[model samples]
Target: MSVPLFDAATPRAPLREGLRSAIDRVLESERFVLGPEVASFERELAAYCGASQAVGVANGTDAITITLRAMGAGPGDEVIVPSFTFYASVEAIVHTGATPVFCDIDADTYCITPETVRAALTPRTKAVIAVHLFGNVAPVGEIQALGVPVLEDAAQAMGSRSAAGRPGSLGVAATFSFYPSKNLACFGDGGAIVTNDDAIAEEARILRFHGSRDKIDYEQVGYNSRLDELQAAILRVQLPHLDQWSDGRMQAARNYEEAGLAELASLPKPVAGASPAWHLYVVSHPDVKRLEGALAAAQVGYKPYYRTPVHRQAPMLEWGAGVDLPATEHAARTHLAIPMSPGLTRAQADEVVAAARAAS
Candidate 1:
């Protein structure tokens, strides 16, 4: 039997009953875009994340760009971000006409700490984007204490919490992606911006829809990035089950721990007060190439979580030309994402563990 990284179909089967009904209801209403479904979903999402408000957007990248624009971050400003994270985090900062100051990540957490952000800070620094990488939350509280407004790139950390609080509630504003692979996902592309600041929330709402509260009135320049009714409806059906799914992923992590995979490779370390969403169970080894080859032979699905850090990417060369990031470079070469999802069965889990042991 071939074990895949994630089987969206198996987990989504149970949601089909409610999801189909919701889709039908939306079709009958004929309110396809920025309609009742999107409004309700926003409210539910905000409440779930312990935020005062949430604004739905077209995708995660839009969520970040819209938040930065809403916060008045633009040209002549710098936004600090981790070089080890996904390119979208830095890409959004660049889109806002702000310079992205790449910072090194903590070797253990694979997350940017307050020290890193502080090192990268300058008078031109306007904000910081703290990414909750691989389901583990960043030390957002300490970073926020630095007096810079932090925007959480929580695309991979929907159900996660740390010592401070939930991802969305930790920062000044938080962004989420409902990409199909995320913990809380829609069928297609979707995203949201959550915040307690009324002004920020209001601005995000307008910015997502061409900077207009009313359809005919244009208040400011904004992008066309509204979450459609169809995707919103589907997200509502899956929202209720998010915690349960996260729990399953945590159990799978425990299974990996019990299998003593740490002896063979480096496993994720537990944060003292964190309850990670377990978006992906990553393991690192010095000999990652050999392990990958063995897994491929056993028909086990595996892939490098991030083989290239953002700083080393061709387009980012101009920004990071002189930067030296030993930890980020090391992580990029060693980390590999094994099969992980709520839908993975015990038999599949055991198969992965056995294959990993054999490979080691």
Candidate 2:
């Protein structure tokens, strides 16, 4: 049996008709950019995430840059971020002219903890990006207690939650990606910045456009990165079903244990009290080569993530020349995310586990 990672098309099968109707509605309106579709998505997304407001943007990376600028981060400021996450997290900080301070992550959770954040803080530290990596929510409330504003990097955690609350509500502000792979994905590129702070929300809205609330005047320089109507309309159609899908993913993750994968490899340990969306069902083994060979021979779909930590990337060499990220390096070497999605079936999951058994 062949198991494939991330069956994006399968999940959309159930929503095909609704998606078509949504597209038709957008076509009838004939308003593409920053129209009613985008406006409604912003409002609905904010409410779903337990936030005061949300501003739609072109993509997840733009969402980060706009939110950072709204929080007053710029040159001469430092923003602490975990090196274990996606490159977009660091790129946005650099785009804002803020120096990116690399932070290490906890080995178990693969997320920056309050201890790690404290170690990276300086007098010039203006903000911290708490990445809710792989659908596991970061400890934003604890990190926020450190004084600097904490931004929730929720690109992979749209349906995730912690005891404190949802991702967008936990941090000063949060950013989400609606890429086809995400939990709350649109058909194509789309993103949003959500916050409880009305001041930040107002600034983000202006920044997403051409730096002006009204088209007549320009305030500060900004980007032309607004989310389009078609994508937003499709996302709106999917929003109501997200919770059920996320629950399904979480249940699928548990099936790995039923297949006895834990006996063969180390499964991810989510943070205490976290109800993760399980965007990727990652596992680690001491011998990576063996695991790789077994999965390939069995035709089990899998992908190694962050083999090179963002801080160690060529463009970031100068920034990370002397940084010591022990835990981040370990995760980079060991982690491999396997097939995971609401559409995943028991037979596919069994194939992956059988491969792991052979590897062990």
Candidate 3:
């Protein structure tokens, strides 16, 4: 009974029938590029996020890169990003020729804090990327008030809610990923950018398709980033089940929370007004090495969300003088992501909770 950190195969299995049918339809139709399926899914996803428009792209990294480029961020400008997120976040900023100002994350939520953003701000800072880390929305509203355009990195938070009780509508643009491990995953890589701004939306749409406004008329020097028709069809099939899947993940998290492992392991608490999508069930402990070993012995799985913060990585974008991020550094060292997916059975969750309690 070896539990991997994530088993995307289980959740994708239920959609096999629909996926097969959709694939066959795509093959028969022969309209494999950005067509009806892609457009329809974009519309549906926009509505789901309470945004006026959504534009699909090749993958999550492309989604961020194109969105930033479409928003007019380039070479000399600076974009503030979370130091605790995946490499792709900063990579996207660098791909645009824009510099990324890395800011530390909150101790609890592991998302960039407004204070950190304020400290990192400069005259060249044009935008802030608020990453909804681990399915919990960050304090985007506060970051917005800083007089800079905000980009919501909702990659792990497709169905997440903000502290204001808003559902994925806090920035000039919001991006979502449909990687295999995401709660609302596609069979392969897929991503979208959601926004209420019509101009931004239109720009992103055009930019995604080689900068073509009409047919072969290149408006700007954009790359090929269109979302494939097949991926869109898969997303259309999975969209309806996202909230239901998120609910199940939340229930599993509640089981761990109620287990009172906080007494021994440092458990994460949900923000005051957030309805997190519970993408990953993370817990921190100073003795993470010992605890993770115990879980491995019990046949449960765990892994650190980030072993090293972004600023410490080799790809050093021209960020300003680095400041000590003690909390972020500690979290990078101590945090562990437990087995958490909608497909995780109650028995499995109980087993994980029991293992955690014993390790504690």
Candidate 4:
């Protein structure tokens, strides 16, 4: 059988019963739009994250955009973002009519460092997006001390925690995605913005629902970005087991590390002082293409999280300062993810490590 790169975990059969019941209740009540399910999920999520409030959105991108808009980050403002991240991070800044300043990441953790962010800051810089890439949390406390609004892109980092707090807990707002591949994925697309600021939460809620605090009154121009009730129901069921699944993935990572395959090639390490959720087990070799081919021949699946960093991506090339970013450039060429998921067993991890060792 072909070894797939990942197989996302789902709620246990018993846990899914509640999800089904919740869906059935929503169906019976015919409250498909921002209803009791969404509200309750938001509250639960907020409490779990140690936030005062949470607002459900259509997806993570909208969560970032709405939060940015509410923060008054607009044209002429620059948002510092790590170049080595998913496009959505930069896309949200651009969507807000703000300029995204690309910054390099740390060699070890593959996360944007506070020093890099400091260097990228300018007179127009208003916000910084700390992306918790590959389930590793960024050093947000130091970044927050820069006196700029911080946006936590926690799409791949659900259930990840730091001593200070969760990924977004230190930021002005944290955005999360329920994409199928994420650690806390839903049945379909969904997202949420978590924050302690009541005003920011209220504004995101309004902006997500067409800028209306009241049903009939339009407060400000906005977009439709509400998370569906069904999706919230799915998330609620999944959230309870999120920590368990994350630990399973972490166990898989430890198994891979103990297998001693990392000695064969340079591997990405989790960020210091942060507990990663192990969204993907990424590593790098000098000749990534050759390694990838070997894995293919061995039927061991792999993927490149960001084959092209956002600043280098064709669509967002304008974000670059034409500076030489050795780290980001090197990462784009060598980064490769091995099979890693809550569903991945030790045997599966061993097989992947064996293939990688042979390739190395």
The parts of candidate 2 lying over 4 Å away from their true place are: none
121-219 in candidate 2: lDDT tens per residue? 999999999999999888888888988789999999989889989989998999999998899898789899999999999999899878998978999
Q: In order, what lDDT does every prediction score? A: 0.88, 0.90, 0.83, 0.85
lDDT of 3: 0.83
State the lDDT of candidate 1 residue by residue for 80-148, as single tens digits: 998888889988988889888998887777888888899898999899999988898988888889889
Task: Report the number of the highest-lDDT candidate.
Answer: 2
Error of 2 at 2 (Å): 1.1
Lowest-lDDT window of 10 residues in candidate 4? 7-16
lDDT of 3 by residue, 1-360 (tens): 466677767766788898899888888889988999998999999888888889988888999999999899999999999888888998999999999888888888888778989998999998999888888888888888888889988888877776564445788888888887887777789999999898988888888877888766788888788888999988898899888788877877776666655676777666557788788888898889988988988889898878877888766634524657777898999999988877677677667777876666
By lDDT, rank the candidates, best first. Answer: 2, 1, 4, 3
Per-residue alpha-carbon lDDT of candidate 4 for residues 1-360, written as tens digits (9 for 90 to 100): 356888763335557678788778778988887888899999999988988899999999999999999988999998898889888888998998999888889977889888889889999998899999899999888888988888899998999888888865778889999988888888889999999999999899899978998769999889899999888888888888888888887887887877786876676687778889888888888889888988898899888878777776777867674756789988888999988877677677678777877776
True-structure lDDT of candidate 1: 0.88
Each prediction's RMSD over C-alphas, in Å, is 1.3, 1.0, 1.7, 1.5
Error at 252, model 1, angstroms: 0.6
Q: Which ten contiguous residues of candidate 2 have the minimum total lDDT?
A: 1-10
